[model samples]
Target: MTSYNKVNGKWTAENDYLLNEVLKKKWGFKGFVVSDWGAAHSTAGSAQAGLDLEMPFGEYYNDSLINKALQTGEIKEELIDDKIRRLLRVRFEAGMFGPQEKQTEGIFHSNLHKQIAYEAAVNGIVLLKNESELLPIDTGKVRKIAVIGPNAAFARIGGGGSSKVTPHYSVSPMEGLKNKLGNSVEISYALGAIIKNDVRIIENSFFENYNGKKGLKAQYFGNINCEGEPSYTRTDTEVNYLWYYDAPYWDFHGADDSNYFSVRWTGKIKAPKSGKYKFQVMHNDGARLTINGNVLINLWKDRRKSEIDEAVIYLEKGQVYDIQLDYYNNGGVSEIKLGWEIPDTDLIKEATELAKKSDLAILCIGLSDHFEGEGRDREFLILENQDKLIKEVVKANSNTIVVIISGTPPILETWVDEVPAIVQAWFAGQEGGNAIADILLGNRNPSGKLPCTFYKSQNDSPGFSDYQNDDLQSKYVEGIYVGYRYLDKHKIEARFPFGHGLSYSKFVYGKPQYALNENNKAEVKFTLTNTGISAGAEVAQLYIKPLNSQVERPEKELKAYKKVYLRSGESKEVIFELNQDDFKYYDTNIHDWQIDKSQFQLLIGSSSQDIRQTTTPKSL
Candidate 1:
């Protein structure tokens, strides 16, 4: 699919050189190219540039625009036919047209899929820092465990935007620990800090209906205004609804249309504490909030996207104030959330106190979809308020383990020295909780490695200044020096090197042996022995360093890697076959790939900076 980014100042959807020449002709990509939602700019230009499909109802590629473009001889009929053929070829090759097999019942959330998710979460978790081997918590000695942080209770299955999915079930870190330890260990929890600055949703415990129920009385109306008798009435647990593509009470009344609908929620809200409170109403179309018969927010207008309107008011502790929320949906995606920011509580203090009393403290903290995602690029590598949380928690409890749940690397220099152990669990799937528990309890050995170098700060990273460029056009400033290559070239030390990961068991690598075969491929062999008592897997990375090259090159480029698992005291011989293409580099002068007939050094190691053995391969 064509991305939202641009190449050489031209949008990817409209770039012919990228979509057609490089992708289709050079790479021979047989699949049809589809543009990202709203990425297609011109119907004729994009279609001619090999964009076979425009997604999400196609604003530019509509029938009228296409027909007009065709009439003007801009987009040929042959091009359209080719696009259709490519699309159909994929479907036909996938057996979609001939599919007659009956799908297995309960296959959507089958146990087999759940087990696969568990295994993936287990293997993908990277042990970044394990100072003095503080991880693999001794459950027998640690009778009391304190799980602290905002993300401890909720399972962060994935990031937001188009990549988000509704899992059948998810286990949070807190729940996972409880399930793993059972009654043998006593667990306590404290919310250290919230990840986002927005107000949290008011819990259902704070609301009470007229009938003294633990929820608000909701009345759904078919019309835009709640003027007549309601179409449906129910006790809604909360004033939060993401009624996308359907109106309120859609299931009960079968109201297919979401364009015209209104809802009224009547309830009594009790203040948890006596202080000033900020109430927020996030809505898409129109919404209003009234407390004690006084209108707080009157945003009764259409909105293209969901927006939040907040009002601050003072309320006494334990006082029941009458609250009413009126909402109407007049368009696209429908969503409404009534939230509030209560008076400041000593959340950190509470967590510290709990940590001091517990035998072990596990801080689950990291970025969520709100901080980082497809379109949401984080401004800083440091997690907001989490470094302070970790610092404070570690001071209270000497034995602390930090579990980072994120899709990207977060700077841990602030509290990394203080913490004994740290685990990088990157948006683990549905079984993430169980996987984390297994790692902590020593049921599974960690073998995952960092895919990218973790810079100490944003300034130390390559292309740091270019990322902040406001202009639409981005110059290729960094060029080939990216990630570890840039760091290696500049002799900049990283917080954690690429392919860096900790395992309970240690592996020793023997001297590498290499020879050129009759096929002109370099065959390398090495022996790996599990020195530690624990059994684990090791990812052996092979890097190729050019001895003398006409053109400038990186310090070393990763050519091949293999993950080898061995039991304690077990030794295995690992082999890697390197072809001619692996030694070739792109020659910009010739606009093609070329290989230099010079000696090359092969470095084998666990990480980019941890080379164990080196061998020189004969020149071609």
Candidate 2:
């Protein structure tokens, strides 16, 4: 047995040993366990338990270690054979070590795949605000359209990490509009603000190969000075490097010796504009930055944690400048970030000029992969500098349509009121541009509803400060009061309630009807009618509320939803069934799910806040 270590005020053992009793035996898990990178700290204990494989590279599951364990009888021979059999079984089932299949040409970028992608993008677009029917732009009357903002030309198809995929081609919002409008409409584009501070070496066109190679050249030294010849040299594909829980894979030494090491990265960056650019470096321990043989930032000392250091420098447009970064890690966690913000004085000027001349300004600005992605949390809930850009663009042209391209609901109190229209365009895939254009041009009716509550600010959330804890202890103190439930229970109003969306056509709902079914389940029925001129889809939401219950519960919980398409003056009936699981709540005293024999309220509406009809139904 291995000794335990104290972490977060609790004694923690290696998961390789803990998982055997918990997952394999207690839970009856037949699947083998694969250890995370560098997670297997022991040889005998881990193998004696249920650990089948060590990922990436095996430090403990080698031949010598297993032989020693087998000779000492710490790990039985059957365990080793069983692990190998499981590995081979999984490999055979996955077809990895089986008969190979031939690849088909053009299958990767087939037309059918592209059409599905386009359909998904258009269907997911949610129309949040359309004041006075400002959308459905008149193509005959509108000749000039100014596509303004940093995201106007930027094609954010997906986020970072594993989700980052290089599509065959991506259509930017500007391109989509142009392709849809054709030669009839003249479109102008302007980057309203420098949304992305710096581009990555692997992705961005602004970064060139440092040593006439593909990526930035990195030289690693064992000592702190980075003197003489480097112990190892490699090319780093990305500049945004973070090595906290684990260290980088190097040949010279093991990860345990990562405490005292130095690295220097040399790269070249091309400036897109001629202005003062802000260079920033976020790092733990010590880091230094230099550009064009000049030391821009020097924070080469041990920092308690991670800190950001920034400096400003003027550069010429189209000229590639030499960039270098020196980083050293001295124990604990390690992280280094190298990025720069482009000068923005000319950005506002260009946007205003384009907006004044155009008939309408389409400001495509919102969060991107840099702000929201895997393993990264947003620092601020509000979209930075977007309010200023919106105000400036709206001032120049009152006929402005603000489109927010983000995965989650962004804070919109700053300039939401000033704009005539707002659209929530989530990280639409390869055909996002065409979908957005279709919605703006009225080629497609927006019907997507908000899945989560859109709060005015981060402070409005019930668990805002308690989201992440450092002590490894998290409590769902809010319980059933999450998202819209929290707002509804506390009588707190959100910027936009959950299940809220707008269509070109108006929808009216009839009184909700409910009854107990033969299966002892509750069935809710309602009718919806499109009372407007255009054909659209309406999402009828059904929420369950307890009229009287012994246990504490939320004001209402959304149980089921149905989206129905209706032509002008068309009506349709929606039916949803709720089972025993829907009415049952966890009873602490009984230690099981329980349902109180009481009257329940059934709600039907377009949104959580816009309940049109409610009726109390008797339970079976």
> Best candidate, lDDT-wise?
1
lDDT for predicted candidate 1 compared with the true structure: 0.85
How well does candidate 2 score on lDDT at residue 389?
A: 84
Error of 1 at 419 (Å): 1.5
lDDT of 1 by residue, 279-393 (tens): 9987888999999998999999888677789999999999999999999888656778888878877778989999999999999999766566666667656776777889999
Off by over 4 Å in 1: 100-102, 201-344, 517-520
TM-score of 2: 0.72
* Alpha carbon lDDT at 242, candidate 2: 51
Each candidate structure's count of clashing pairs = 0, 0
285: Cα error in model 1, Å = 4.6
Model 2 C-alpha lDDT versus the unseen true structure: 0.78
Cα deviation at 191, candidate 2, in Å, is: 0.4
Runs in model 2 with CA error above 4 Å? 1-101, 199-345, 467-472, 518-520, 589-591
- Which pairs clash inside model 1? none
Local lDDT at 400 for model 2: 94
Q: How many backbone clashes does candidate 1 have?
A: 0
Q: What is the lDDT of residue 317 in candidate 2?
A: 97
